[model samples]
Target: MTESLDDTALDRLFRTARTRNGWTDRPVAEALLRQVYDLAKMGPTSANVSPARFVFVASAAAKARLAPHLSNTNRPKALAAPVCAIVAFDLDFAQRIPELFPNNPGAQAWFADPKVAEVTAFRNGSLQGAYLMLAARALGLDCGPMSGFSQSGLDAEFFAGTSWRSNFLCSLGYGSDENLFPRNPRLAFEDACRVL
Candidate 1:
């Protein structure tokens, strides 16, 4: 019997989702990472271009390679986490747009221009990355998404010889409540939203 998600589950997964920094020594299994990716891929993208590419860094050597690229504030937490996902975008995403946007004629050409390619890749890739985080949370993992790293350094060390470019990095693991900051306030709907 399949049980429907209740409000408690929804609140835990969405309303209470926070950017966790501290982590326990527990490991994240490869199978769980695969499950997260599978769920995240179902999220929609513009033209279904699906520009995001993930490099899951789990091995000790891979983490070593990533260390020098991170800012001091992010390094310790990243090292303690069980895995780090290098979320990237392929510059040649247009090659797949024809298959993704079958009925839209000349859709692939929209990303042929360098500027257009950059915009599409970053925007869609970031959206996919967000889905990745939610999916991870649903799968009982905590995430620390950070952009305080050196993208160029990561590209040179990890993404060399590929069309993929580093967009951001996310540390994944079981979070420790000990280091968590108090939840901050959010703008009320009336203050932040505008009616059309």
Candidate 2:
């Protein structure tokens, strides 16, 4: 087994993560995408339900299919990015919860109700999506996460026959400094945190 690593690299990765708007006209290889998934899948989820699924739209035809689903504000950036990921959640995630949460009996039953399924799908999918962004950043890729797309349109166009449902869209590529928005001010740590 390999020795444990230090935390400095993780801290730097988080600190340096930026929401990129402009991208270089370079392709993100499938190998890199696989590596990103390998890292992201390690993140913890409720009962390890692991609902998030990704569809990497890199072909011209796929991009064309995705274009119509994006909002006017996001279309340009979406088209420019090397890869656009359709982040989704499987409706039947509970079926695999037993394997994911082997230590806990009846864990899968927690999401058996219709209302619980909806809640778990969105919540765990969102968490996994965030892990994806961090993983991409760690792999030296820039990300533009957007929610401006028409989710219903995406579902109809790309996920019509699948159990997967759209959660959000993320564009990944090599970013350019030319088109970045000015960094906005953030709440101070004290103001944003509360210790009980």
All models, RMSD in angstroms: 2.6, 2.6
lDDT of 2 at 80: 92
Mark the 10 consecutive residues where model 1 has the least summed lDDT: 8-17
Error of 2 at 65 (Å): 0.6
lDDT of model 2 at position 20: 86
Question: Backbone clashes per model, in order?
Answer: 0, 0
Candidate 1 local Cα displacement, residue 107, angstroms:
1.7
What is the per-residue lDDT of model 1 for residues 126-149, given as tens digits with 9 covering 90 to 100?
Answer: 999999998999989989999999
Which candidate number would show the highest TM-score if scored against the true structure? 1
**Cα lDDT of all candidates, in order?**
0.91, 0.89
**For residues 1-196, could you state the per-residue lDDT of candidate 2 as single tens digits?**
4964457666536655678889999889999999999999999988788999999999999999999999998999989999999999998888887788889858888878978997898899999999999899888899999999998899999989888899989999999985788877889989999988
TM-score of each: 0.93, 0.91
Question: Which candidate number maximizes lDDT?
Answer: 1
